[model samples]
Target chain A: MTGAPLLAVNNIEVIYDHVILVLKGVSLQVPEEGIVALLGANGAGKTTTLKAVSNLLGAERGDVTKGTIEYRGERVEKLSPNELVTRGVVQVMEGRHCFGHLTVEENLMTGAYTRTDGRGAIRDDLDLVYRYFPRLQQRRTSQAGYVSGGEQQMTAIGRALMSKPKMILLDEPSMGLAPQLVEEIFEIVKRLNEEEKVSFLLAEQNTNIALKYARYGYILENGRVVMDGNAAELAANEDVKEFYLGLSGTKRKSYRDVKHYRRRKRWLS
Target chain B: MADLFFFLEVLIGGLLSGVLYSLVALGFVLIYKASGVFNFAQGAMVLLAGLTFVRLTQILGSEHPWDGMFVLALAITFAVMIALAFAVERVVLRPLVNQAQIIMFMATIGLTFFLEGAAQGVWGSQVHRLNLGVSELPIIIGDVLLPPLDLVAAAAAAAMVAGLAVFFSRTRIGRALRAVADDHQAALSVGIPLQSIWVVVWSVAGIVALFAGLVWGAKLGVQFSLTLVALKALPVLILGGFTSIPGAIIGGLIIGASEKLAEVFIGPLVGGAIENWFPYMLALVFLLFRPQGLFGEKIIKRV
Candidate 1:
């Protein structure tokens, strides 16, 4: 791990539309050139945490009511999302929100909107993305909406890569994909971290896949981090194995293990 | 031969007017495409731009058409439109960000009434002549005489549409715009500023409004009635697909040519004034066949 974390979320609290609290005191960090995963199920404030770091919560009428976010040791809680991008932080939102109307290449091009480095550099990066995602290159001219779900997910990640970010805040990269596709994407992510040197703060519900790749992991539940540790440590935890990994020392959970293995003796019994 | 010439003239005239309708609809498409707001106030924006231009020209002395007043008034009126766009973005859209699409639509409805009243109150409800220096005299071509003013207006509209089409397809800013329109959250996440794009789109729509206002004001005379031209564009938008730029132009052309042909040929058989309601009937029928409109993205259902 690097000497200092690349990105830090210091006890942030997010509230939507001034009423509903979403993320409550969520704190996490991504070390430089490290893959850190934020693990959770639906409504566990996983997406909200990533959005807070990227400063994208404002558009959804969401406010980071408390705490500060730091990127490269500079406070970035109040910067506009684009400014954060300029400073080398990009977020690939969940649902693979590729521009449905645009061609795959065009969707990737939009990622370079704020780039003043001229077309040549952007073009080189585009070719780089195509190299990393050969499937995207094959479907370059197709409308993104018409592509398979896996391709759309790849396009979303490829779009994020177009920005040439120092760090990526990727939310639910494996959502709604098949097991094979999920593993394939995580594999590409690991390579990007190693080769491109882009730090990632990944949010995922697929705990088994995430723990397999991520160097560190934080488990969130009901708007707060329930546990956090090294990937192997988190993977070996008995509760994590039972709830998230679905592996109570078996290839798959049997009916009894999944349902009611803990039927204990009560006073009446 | 004489009947054919007359038919040709009617067709040409209708097509020319239809291009003007497309001009107004183009403004709506810009805002709608970028931010998903069906800006009902586009007509009001047209009225304001027309009034602002005509009054400024008179205030600066209208006799100096080739020299001082015309270009100066146009520039000033365009500035006013941009400023209005900025103000609307701040006052109307900014607060209402993330509100339901229907609520935004309704806000634009309120904006329509407010702007209509504001334009009249500020400029006074007086009819003013707007001569864009295009000669009103008809030009004879073979057996038919064509109005030069309508021809000029059609050319201007064509040029603007071409420029916009190229800008959207060829430029980075344009791609960013489409991205913003497709998904605000994703756009922001990828570093496209949602609010800035909104302001730019509204401003571009404002520029379009200025051009539309000038042409329509010249043809119909600048007055309260100028706002009603926005109504003509509605049928055009429905036919073109509210989200597509080329659809607006094509829709406008279809509406214009058909309504005129229908009015001329079918009017005698029926009562008359088919021009009054023909476009709407056509648009209604089109909705039945293609709800997304020509060139509009198909509405995909998950079920």
Candidate 2:
């Protein structure tokens, strides 16, 4: 309750090959115990922002040209992905990224890669992850690739939990899922947040569902934040409504007009 | 009758040689399985181990007799291989872990050149006799004369393969290695130190290489020419899956037997030197039909 932000993503810009400016002046904060959501459309640089923060932006070929990322007030911009994991900054990545040949249990065990706890303690936590995700326990010995999409997503999140991370940067947890599964996944996320007090900064395209779980939210459009506030406030905003909420308003026409206007602005610039 | 006996002799000889080839191939499979890198320098590592054993025996046992010299030489070589494995892991593999597969593969090729030069620099470029003194007398039972050295090579290869199988399937370190081989990122997340696993694998591969060198040296005098024996292993690998130990063994036996048979029965029809190209030709045919090799996992590419 009385400490610096768990993670501070200051005005950072990420460019791919120095030409494809993916993330332009992006910034966000995750309090020690809060669920922060990053909402954006496809290719809105949500994943890029997470990658940049994780110090895993694939070197100069995919560089974060500007801005600073600090975790617990320590600059982690220059650290390797493994170093970031060691510092307890773990990302559950966009896709499941589960080891296809490994069992669900093995996959979960990998999450605790950075941990140096006793085997029994690790086993106890693994049981806890299984308790939270019963389906994984049921299919513990099964190959991860053979699991259903929903189950794979659960395994991914569960794997990250094994690390006992200070904060998790979830990239599109609900991607490529059935609606019911999406709801189930988000419900689990909400439960995890309330029960464990684990911090999360989820990048998601499903605004309606994302807003339901996130206490605070930032809306990204074309690599920049156009709207930011409490989830409910932003959910109610005209711009957020017109663009993401599918609400009919003058903001809808203006949003579409800006796309056309941006081309002209680009030409002039 | 003499012609048939000669045919059988060559067949047995080739099969024995193939067993040795398979042993070397197993080393390749172990490293490749743990890490996706083909470890093109596996051949060089084998030659290096062979040279090291010869040099150690010469330098360490010159005053002493050759009684337990073979075992002592092997022990020294094992230690050297382990150190070499660590060096390669820290210096060559660790930095190139995130690089492209091609780059990693090329780096191993470079490693091959470095090892070859270093081996020659250390052992010099002379053929030395390694009389394993393990009863080279051929056991004659009925009409068959089986060389004890050949029997030792075959048994040793089988025993080593079995031992490796048990190590991988039953041990925690082996399980961790398999996990790293399956998915490096996932393995990292689980807290498996990839560097440690790579070192262990390379060390194990090095041990296997030394064992191969010993058996092979017993049959053919140890020299730079010993490295050329590793070429037969390539065909064995092509026949066996890149990561499959059994594939290497079976592929080796087939290549070894076929080449000898070709030399004995088919050599007269095709002039000579069929032994040189027979394994490769067999491997090329296997490749055309089953590119994944006998034991390799089939990778289906989808658009």
Predicted structure with the largest lDDT when compared to the true one: 1
lDDT of 2 at B42: 81
Could you give candidate 2's per-residue lDDT for residues B1-303 as a string of tens digits?
867666677778788878888988888888888888888888788789888888888877643436576568767788899999999999999787678888999999899999999999978978878777678678875456778888887987788889988887655677678778877765654456688899999999989888888777767778777677777788999999897888999888998899888887798998988889988999999989999999886552212
> Which stretches of model 1 miss by more than 4 angstroms?
A250-253, A263-269, B300-303
Chain A vs. true chain A, TM-score per candidate?
A: 0.94, 0.89
Once fitted onto the true fold, the runs of candidate 2 whose alpha carbons sit more than 4 angstroms away are A1-3, A15-21, A58-66, A249-269, B1-15, B62-75, B94-97, B140-143, B166-173, B185-196, B265-272, B300-303
Model 2 chain A: worst 10 consecutive residues (lDDT sum): A260-269
Question: Would you list the clashing residue pairs of candidate 2?
Answer: A110-B189, A110-B190, A113-B190, A113-B191, B241-B296
Tell me how far the alpha carbon of residue B48 in candidate 1 is from the true structure, in angstroms, after superposition: 1.0
Q: Candidate 1's error at B106, in angstroms?
A: 2.2
Interface RMSD (Å) of candidate 2: 3.8
Best by TM-score: 1
Docking class of 2: acceptable
lDDT for residue A198 in candidate 2, whole number 0-100: 78
Residue lDDT tens for model 1, B179-267: 88888888988899877888889989989998998899888999888889999998999999999999999999989999999999999
